[model samples]
Target: MFNKLFGKPKAKGKDAKANVKTVATALSSMERINENLDMLEKKEQILQRKIAAELAKATEYSKAKNKRAAINCLKKKKLFEAQAEQLAAYQLRLHDQMILLEGAKATTDTVDALRSSAVAMKAIQKQTKIDDVDRTMEDISEQQDNMKQIQDALTGPVGVASDFDEDELEAELEELEGTDLDEQLHESMSNVPYAQEPIMSSPEAAVPIPAPSKRTPPEKTPVHDRSEDEELAALQKEMAL
Candidate 1:
């Protein structure tokens, strides 16, 4: 374990050595098997040649009218044929062993790979727990919330403006608008002449103003106004000079 983190792992070294040993063993076995197969093949071919030779000899003996010699040659050929058959059987057995070894090697490699993957997955599970993952995600969410709060604090409206009431501001705005409108109205009034003011008429350039119509009961002369007619006749007599 220390070597895995610091340097070369002892387990790896051992596995490599074991792999090399297995490969060497397989290579050596294959070489021996092939060598044996080659020797068996050569031996079988030699036996076949010997059988052919014996057959030719037997034929020659028969042609010479020698029955015993022909029979002996045929017997030798039969023995060589049997030996060749045994060699073929041995070759077949070696081939079967070679095939089995290769299949077993392939199976071993596949199992080892699966075992290694399982170990790695086990190690990863040991390092990363479900509880730890949940805690990490929770921490991330908490940090995000904290950061959002900080950003809001940084960018938010501040001090008096932030605390001001919308109602008060609207009321103040309306007051200012009212004051400005009053000023505009006063300025316009100052620039215009008053339409309701009475205009006095000049006696020399007199305009014959029509009197307003009055109701007879409301305009009846009182006794003092009727007695003024006698004074008006005495004033006209003094003006006759």
Candidate 2:
């Protein structure tokens, strides 16, 4: 009737919950084990002290030559030795458990450290790439500025003015040379006379002069004077006579 009212009792065995609870319990027990180890170490020390005291009592009994006391002291010594051995075994087990737990903890820490390093390396790589891009942009900007400066120098007003001055100087020099040549020619012309005659005369002016002709005397008139001449001769002869 109760089975019918409550349906059926649940079967209890090891389940997921139970397994989790077991692992939790084991971890709790491990903590207790460490505490117990510390307690056992203290107990071991006490047992070692007891064993030494028993040994001293046995030795004193042996020297006293008392058989019953010596036997009792030997029994006490044996009991102390047995307790010490049990404590030593418990300490050995605790040491093994502690060694295993320490190794597991070290391995877990190492894995975590490696994961952290990998994440840091990824961050560093990203930052380095960004820095490189910024540097490249800066370099390009600097180069552009330098090129602009060079272009300005090539096309500036000073450059044009210098070229203009050179051309003007060349033109002035050519004009000066032309003026000097004209002045020299004028000076030479002024120094020489224009009216000087040629050393050799022309052919027409070189003709020779002709000589003068000879003339004859006029003829004498003799008949008219002959009669006069005879009379004059007769007078002259009479006066002489």
Candidate 3:
């Protein structure tokens, strides 16, 4: 039983170590493949140069009418071309292997990252539950409400201005306006002159004054005002004498 318990962990550890080594080996192999590909490319370039040189020699020999030398040069060019083709095929296989290894590495890395992320998520969930999240949200909402209430209290009006009677305010305003209007009307009335009766020469008796087109009520005229008008009329009559 103890062996069964302990053996599992040992096996798991060994498997993990093996996986790491495998990944490392894959990366090393990919590097080696790239190096080999580079070597193959260099070899192909040299072969192409040799082939070009051989073809040039073949052309020169053909121009000189030396068929045997030209044929030998062409044969050398064919060998070089075959070697170049073989190198190209090797490079192509290496490239395909590199692409597959890179793809596999990327997939393995992605899976490992996702597994780590899932583990992190599980640990976070263990520390913080759905119920805890709900409680936190409620606390936040409560704090927001309390802050809003505090702000409202701080920014509110200081007095009971809004609680005052609207009717009483309107009445006071009306009384003030009426008092101002009365003073203005009285000032205008005092400035107005009484209409005068005009006298003519010895042949003419007197010309009666024309009636005013506008008039105010007798009750509307102030009591002190009637006496002033009468006094003005009496002074005018005396001046005529």
Off by over 4 Å in 2: 1-30, 119-157, 160-241
lDDT of each: 0.74, 0.66, 0.75
lDDT of 2 by residue, 1-241 (tens): 2223223212235543554454445455567777899899899899889888878888898899877888898898899889889989988988898677556544544654576578789988987897798999999999999999999988877745666777788999999999999999988755653223232256853423234325432333343354644534443333333
lDDT of 3: 0.75
Query: What's the residue-level lDDT of 62 in candidate 1?
Result: 100
lDDT of 1 by residue, 1-241 (tens): 2122223212246776786567557656776888999999999999999999999999999999999999999999999999999999999999999887667666656666776788899999999999999999999999999999999999988987799888998999999999999999988755653223223235553334444445332323333344444434433333332
**Which candidate order results from sorting by lDDT in descending order?**
3, 1, 2
Question: What is the Cα-based lDDT of residue 232 in candidate 2?
Answer: 45
**TM-score, predicted candidate 1 vs. hidden true structure:** 0.50
- Candidate 3 lDDT, 49-87, residue by residue in tens: 999999999999999999999999999999999999999
Q: After superposition, how far is residue 48 of candidate 2 from its true place, in Å?
A: 2.0
Point out the higher-scoring one by TM-score: 1 or 2. Answer: 1
* TM-score of each model, paired residue for residue: 0.50, 0.42, 0.55
Question: Which residue ranges in model 3 land beyond 4 Å of their true spot?
Answer: 1-19, 137-221, 224-241
Q: Pick the candidate with the highest TM-score.
A: 3
Best by lDDT: 3
**The 10-residue segment with the lowest total lDDT in model 2:** 2-11
* Stretch of 10 with least lDDT, candidate 3: 2-11
Candidate 2 Cα deviation (angstroms), residue 157: 8.4
